[model samples]
Each structure stands twice: as C-alpha cells, then as structure tokens.
Target: MTAVPVFLYHAVSDNPPRWLAPFTVSPRTFVEHLNMIADSGLRVVPLRQLVTTLLGGPPLPPRSAVLTFDDGYADFASTVAPLLAGRGLPATLYVTTGALHASGTPSGRGPFPSAATLSWGQLRELDAAGFEIGGHTKTHPQLDTLPRTSVREEVGGCKREIEDALGHPVDSFAYPHGYSSRTVRTLVWETGWTSAAAVRGPSALSSNRDDPLRFARLMVRADTDRKRFELWAQGEGAPVAPFAEGLRTRGWRAYRRARAVTGHPYRALPTDEG
Candidate 1:
C-alpha cells in the first residue's frame, strides 16, 4: 500500500482570527514543512496527478505527496502562493465562493466566521499563476446535514459560480469541515466534480485505492508539530485511507443532523475540533 500525504491547510499566517488560529500555520513553520518535504525526498505533485492515479489513469511516482488548502484565506494569496511559487511547487486551493471578499462586501453569505478571505480578483490571479483553484461550496455548510435540494444548490451552484468567475471548468471540490455523507458525495459527483477532498480525522493518509470523491487528507494545523509532520512526510505516522466509516462517525453525523433540524447546527470549525 503506497501512502500519499495529501496535506490540507487553511490560513497560513502569524496573526489569524481566534477561531481560525488552531488551523493556521505561521509562514516560518510553513517554510520549514516545505523544506522538510524536500529534505525527505518526497515530491510535491499537483493534486490532479494523484487524482489521475486514483482514477486508474496511471501510477504516481514513488514518494509523491500533494498540497491542498481549504477555505480561501487572504493569506493564501498574500503569503502561501509566493512561497509555493518560490519553491516551484504545485498546489490546489479550494475557495468558499460566498466568503470571498469583493469590493467592500462578501460575494455571498457564507457561514464562516469573520476573517480576511480571498477576493475574486485574487483568485483569478492565483489561477493564472498555475495554482489549481477548486470549489469549497458557495457558503461553507455541512453538506451531509443539509436537505437534498440544498445540497444540490450548494454543490452544483458553487461550481457554476467559480466557472463564471474563472471562465473555465473546475473539477475538484472539498467538503466543508470535512463532513459528507453518501448522499452528499453523490450530489457532488452529479454536480460534475471529478475529485472531492475529505478529512479522515488525524493520522490518515490518502492512497491509490482511496475513493476519488471522498479521498482522505492529512490536515496540517498550528498544533501539528515538527515531529508529527516529519513522520507524515515519511508516511510512517498515519493509516492509509479506503477504510470503512466506523460507528462513531455515523453517530456523530446523526448528532449533527439532529442539531441542524433544531436550527442549532454546530458552528464551522477545524475538522478535528468536532
């Protein structure tokens, strides 16, 4: 079983909102992680390469890893992109379309907390710069907990919004807060998404056998210390994906759905926080 670390990141900044701080990594630490990946001889490949392999197109080069960022934070344009461009690395950035800052207002109403998010112009620039821009829903909502109609709107509507903005089709989608059920995944595929990202909790690495629509990702957070990250880079600390969804996951989903029905759904937070 060849393990591929599809590293997930959020905001990369020294100063982040209190709510986002747990998921944020400082620029210095981000550089260190990149350097460590290079030192370990692991190649950072574009996410589509891994997706192609998962789709049975071809085998990935040995020791290949992926870089993906969820939620379009302003720091991605201001800090993360320059660093990645400097290293000549490829990455995929999934943006919550509604949360994007445009003019003096958000493009749409998103469920995310108050923070500096990427604007549409910045996203276009990032796309032009060779960064793969993917969809993270119009408003960041838990897809599994929403009604089927709403799921379609969120899943398909987001693809349309990004395509309208970018003037090209985007193939990748990521579940908000890493929550997705079978229904949600089906909706995503019906909406024409080729690959979708999900957090398989901590210590799980995506592999060739992982589901293209619900591939696992190893989240890199503020608390992800050097030792743990190094181990992940070596594919030694995490279990490879394509595992069965356990009873605990189903129970958690039930609880969240119940909360949603009561109009008191869980607030958006890092995937591990729930």
Candidate 2:
C-alpha cells in the first residue's frame, strides 16, 4: 500500500499561548522538518491531489506528502506562509470562522484558548497567496458530540461563511479536535465538503485507500523531533489509514458524549492528542 503522509500543524511560533504550546512548533524546528522532507526525497503536494487520488481520480506521484494547518493561527500568516512560499510548497489552511480575530478582538467566539488568531484580512491575503483555505467550523466544537441541528449549523454554516467572505466555494473541511462520528461525517458530506481531515491518534498516515471524508493525518507537534519526523517522511513509523475504529476510541467517544449530556463535555483544549 502506498502511504501518503498528510502532516497537520497548529501554531508555528517560538512564543505560543500556554494552552497552545503543546501543539506549537518553533519556526526553527519547522524549517528542520521541511529540510528533512526534502532530504527524504518526498514531494510536497497540495491536499487536493491526495483527495483526488483517494476518490479514484488519479494515482498520486510516488512518495507524495501534504501540508495542512488548523485553527488559523496568526503565526501562519506571519511566519509559516513565508517559509512555505519560499520553498514554493503548497498547503491547505483550515480556519475556525468564529476564532478569527476581528474588530480589535484578540480572538472570536470559538472554544479555543486566548491566542493571536488570523484576522479576516490576513486570511484573504493568505488565500490570495495560493494557500488553499478550508473550513474548521464556526466555533470549533466537537461535531460528534453536538446535536444534529447544531452539527449542521456548525458544518454547513462554516462553509457558507467562508464562501461569503472568500467569494468562492471551499471544498475541504477538518473536524475540530479530529473528532467525528458516522453522523458527523454524513453531515459534513451533506454540507458539500469534498474532503475532511482527521488525526488518527499519534503516528498515523493517510493512504490511497483512506476515506476522503475522514482521511487520516499525522500531527507535527512541539515534541515531534527529527527522528520521528524523518520516520514519517519515509512512511516507516506510522500505521496507514483504513483501519477499523478501535474499541478504545469508541469508549472514549461514549465518555465524551455522556459528559456532553451533562452539559460539561470534555474540553479538548486544541485537540485530543491521544
């Protein structure tokens, strides 16, 4: 099986919020990872190329990988974009509509902790610079735990919001905290999303056979060191996707759903990281 590693990143900064530090990678480390990808001889492709291959459109070039970022962090505009643009690499950026900074607000109405998020104008500039802009919900809630109506509002409403702002249709969507159930995925598809990114625990890679609506992604975190990243770039350290959802994952979801019922769901600050 051909493994395509779709790398997911959050904040790329030396100084991130305390809450976001776990997922943040310094600019220096990020550059090292990019160099490692080049050294490993893996081509960085746009996410839609992988999606097209998964949907049976065409076979991906050999040893292709993807770059994707979540939550629209301000560092993406200031730091990440220049680096990627310098390398002429393509990437997809999924933004939480409600978390985007606007009108002097540090952050919007999302569940994320306080951080410098991207502004709408900056988002447009990023979009214009050729980075694919995708939706990450309006308020960054766990879709699987919400009611169907709320889920629809979050999923569908986000697409509409981004389209209204960007003046063009966006096809990619990423599940907040990488949590999605059958119902949530169905709702995402019904809302017209062509692809949705999901983190498959730690050290998992998306393959050609992976589901387009719930494709696996390998997360690059603060602790993702050189050895591990090289292993992922070589497609050697992770399990490829199209595996069954384990019993433990189901149990965890059940627990989170139970907590949601009590109106006190487990807040996965940025992600579940499990």
Candidate 2 local lDDT, 162-255, one digit each (tens) = 9988899999999999999999999999999999999877658889899999899999888888889989999879999989998888998899
TM-score of each: 0.96, 0.97
Extract clashing residue pairs from model 1.
none
Number of clashes found in candidate 2: 0
TM-score of 2: 0.97
State the C-alpha lDDT per candidate: 0.89, 0.90
lDDT of 1 by residue, 155-211 (tens): 899899999999999999999888899999998998999999998855489898899
10 residues in a row with least lDDT, candidate 1? 103-112
Which ranges in model 2 have alpha carbons more than 4 Å from their true place? Answer: 103-109
Worst 10 residues of 2 by lDDT: 102-111
